[model samples]
Target: MDRFTERDQLIRKWIYAAAATIKESFDDELDIERKSNRNDLVTNMDKAIEKQFIEKIQHFFPGERILGEEGLGDEISLLDGVVWIIDPIDGTLNFVKQQDDFAIMIAIYEDGKGQLGYIYDVMQDKLYSARTGKGAYCNKRLLPTIEDRPLKEGLVAISSALMSKEEGLARTVGRASSGVRLIGSAGIETAHVASGRLIGYLAATLAPWDIAAGKIIAEEVGLIYTKLNGDKVDLLQKTPVLVASPTAHKEIIELLKSQKI
Candidate 1:
């Protein structure tokens, strides 16, 4: 098997095809429904797009396992072989409300190691993709090497939920960065980190589907992708995750540990 094409090119084509389908599905208005809460949303477009990805993968790569949002894929308990993790709509809320700022994220792992990652910002027509040993890219351009920047010198991405769960994180973000920005999608935030727009990102409760592509591309550019306490991330579980340049990652972790909220 052509490992790179199986992982990167196929998924990239899948995302583009899914994007077209989703765009047509939502040309007028979206049928948005709450998943867990008002804050957690699911749309018909989300389901359709996810289904499209799952079906394409099943057709092209018959034996591969899929772990996708919207429950369109198989019930997977282990990541043993070729595993595809998909977030059909990375920002469903944004897609439903603003029709922008959402993304389609796909990541493929072989034996639990990231082999390919793709994050497509549908609204902006941007695709961020990476393959193991090939480096990351934003559309056609290869991403530059990630340079370590201090917290005070660059913007940092943090979720608003941290303000309630970890009180000090909000305060720390307020004091630490030149600015604090909240983009509803983890994929977008991590893409920014990969491109050197944001120095760091931290979120408390994220699903595996949410950050899989983000973590892969972030690390491809020499950015640190790990748990909040600086542990390696497990692609099958949820955790408090952080992605950032090396300097900002260390600083943010130390700050979070000290406050301990």
Candidate 2:
């Protein structure tokens, strides 16, 4: 089998294993702590899940390096060789608050290029994945390329942070769209866009793990990804992003002045 095909098979198993762990912890008392502030939290489950993935990836792909949210993986400055970027639980707040709308995600890169990405919506039991030129998928079903939609024709998701801090920004975009949603999880939000359910998504700030898998899958289905300032998103940095259908991207990009972000 080709390299990614072989790795993809095993990666699915790893994601499922992570999901199993997550489901098993729902009834248990969570160990939560704040990162940057009270709003940015991490739990014991997140650390355990990241460690779990590091162990499995090391076992299967011994030489590959991993970059995980919980600092269990290697400390690499660059994506030189095979690297796995993982977010054990994308929406920790949602997981803690509602146990829904969260996801498990992994993105595999080889020599700095995205080879495969996976986003498993734990409660929904839907897996969105993609390989270069192979198209995106939701579980066993293939997703058709997203229709090139404009901002007014469909629902869009803007980060709660952005909606609260930049009401003017929200008003400019919201008045032009059908509606706005507040899905806290970037992976699930991106997957929805990949699935053509949401026309676009924006976030005030996102780490590498947040967008790693979603970027690959969303782009596989023709969603355009870039910074809020119209710059290409750097996969290794934590920055704001605007991911949408081609037309919507153009519309939103133009509506907001360069200094808006």
Each prediction's RMSD to truth: 1.4, 1.1
Instruction: List the global CA lDDT of all models.
Output: 0.86, 0.91
Give lDDT tens digits, candidate 2, residues 148-202: 9789999999999888878889888988999998889999999999999999998
Estimate TM-scores for all models: 0.95, 0.97
Q: After superposition, how far is residue 99 of candidate 1 from its true place, in Å?
A: 0.5
Question: Model 1: per-residue lDDT, tens digit, 105-224?
Answer: 999888889888999999889999998778999999999889888889999888766656776677776588888888889899899899999999888878999978888898899999
Model 2, residue 12: distance off in Å is: 0.7
Off by over 4 Å in 2: none
Error of 1 at 196 (Å): 0.4
Compared to the true structure, candidate 2 yields what TM-score?
Answer: 0.97
